[model samples]
Target: MESRNPVIRRYADFQKPGSVLGNNQGRYDGNVITSTPVDETTQTFPGRTPAKPGERVVTMDDVVMKSFAMLALLLVGAFVGWNAPGLAIIAAIAGLVLGLVNTFKKNVSPVLVVAYALLQGVFVGGISYIYQNLVVADGTNIVGNTIMCTMVAFGTMLFLFKSGIIKVDAKFTRMMMVAMVSYLVIAVISIIASFMGVGGGWGFYGVGGIGILLALFGVGLASFSLMLDFQSIRQAISMGLPEKESWRLAFGLTVTLVWLYLEMLRLFAILAGRRE
Candidate 1:
């Protein structure tokens, strides 16, 4: 089955591969869902046949390149955030809005996607600086370790998917969806608890053993979420989606990566806090 990810699921093309024309949002004139042959009236981009015109199909390379661009922008934003960690809250709110817009928007806007990356990067960098400078007492290089852990998780998941060790079938998707929802509810409760001065203001996650367990769970969930991202990319390319959709896929992947990194960072911080 296709991923339950809102960003990936919005595309009708993913539901019925090659059913829609290779236009923005995979729709034709007036958002019609027709399967009729591409008549001369259909528009093209630059490399397609005369029948379908020159519209280019989505490719792995397109996703890779767009992902790189998004990451670069994020790094730039992270640099700024590292210098001024105070921007974390403002950037986080702004980034959440942009992320939601980019995820559900009908037409993929590369500009907005990259903007989200930059804003989220600020949040990430801000939190990372706090962890490195204020949290760790032993100079454990927690931030660097978190980055390495995130990368390892990514590579491990990719290997599992490629080696056929883990498959994104309907059952797996359903289970992940359920787990995500449950974890979200718990996270909300934990936040409320934290605000109420529970567990030293860390919520359920700051309650020693329970907090560490929850943090580990979060890291695991985020790691597995990467599989769904990978599956979405594969499906998009196989469905022959429009090249512009690459921006959407890249955005989805970036979102997962950011989530994974954040989870890892939190986990490391918790362990370091315990040590302190």
Candidate 2:
């Protein structure tokens, strides 16, 4: 998946031409990097040594930049859509288009990603607004609360990583991967059941234990996904990836955040329904 901070960084540095030395200038070896040769034969380094080895220079600049940009765009779209579901539908369609464009394009485009964010925002906000109108009064605030909770969880994970409270080793990754895939399978089955008119196996909002469990499960998967994303981004930086792929990294992060928020929203709805 194309996510926030990928484990692999694109090395734009590799695009730089290699060093070439001329035969006549072979003896002119100095501190300068001019194309001068040191001997009668020309010396050229088509392929060189390992790139930027042992560099642990991971910066949060890329994450902050892309995330903020996407958030801002999304807010605007969401606000508009919240007021009008029609607009939300359009935004959703546009978002789908932009998402495809971003994923399939050979080159990454920040504009497209930002556009996609806006569209998704509209759809989310509009849906929240509709939920408020359809459910009990002031139901829309539920979405707000869900958003806050999701943010808190995301920040918690980040802080844990930064503070070294979490161990992100291969074994841990393997466990998480297995859990995530299994969770996805369960989700797919639940969706199919729902389509077949099977109510969460629970009466009313309870939709049964399956519904409630899936809601909570989504939250956990999304939160764990964030850990994976941050780790990937950091490794990419150490590997010295190009800056242009910031959009790719940003796209990944956006996906996780969205998934996390949606899960929070669903979990909240479940809790709210139980109270009623």
Task: For candidate 2, give the lDDT.
Answer: 0.62
Q: Which stretches of candidate 1 lie over 4 Å from their true place?
A: 1-5, 8-53
lDDT of 1 by residue, 1-276 (tens): 333344434432323333333433232322222344543323222222211234566778899999899889888999999999999999999998998888668777888998998999999999899989987787888999998999899999999999989987656766777788898889989999989999888899899899999999999998888887788777656445567888988898898888889889988988988887
* Steric clashes per prediction: 4, 13
Model 2 clash tally, residue pairs: 13
Candidate 2: worst-modelled 10 consecutive residues by lDDT: 7-16
Q: What is candidate 2's lDDT per residue for 1-276, written digit by digit as tens?
A: 122222211211212234333343212112112233343222221222112323222245866797788888878877888888778777777777777677657666777887788889888888777655654353446887887898899899999888888866556566666676677677767667666666744222247676677778779878977877676566444333345555666776776787788778777766766666
Q: lDDT per model, in order?
A: 0.76, 0.62
Candidate 2 TM-score, true structure as reference: 0.73
Which one is best on TM-score? Answer: 1
TM-scores of the models, in the given order?
A: 0.84, 0.73
Q: Judged by lDDT, which candidate is best?
A: 1
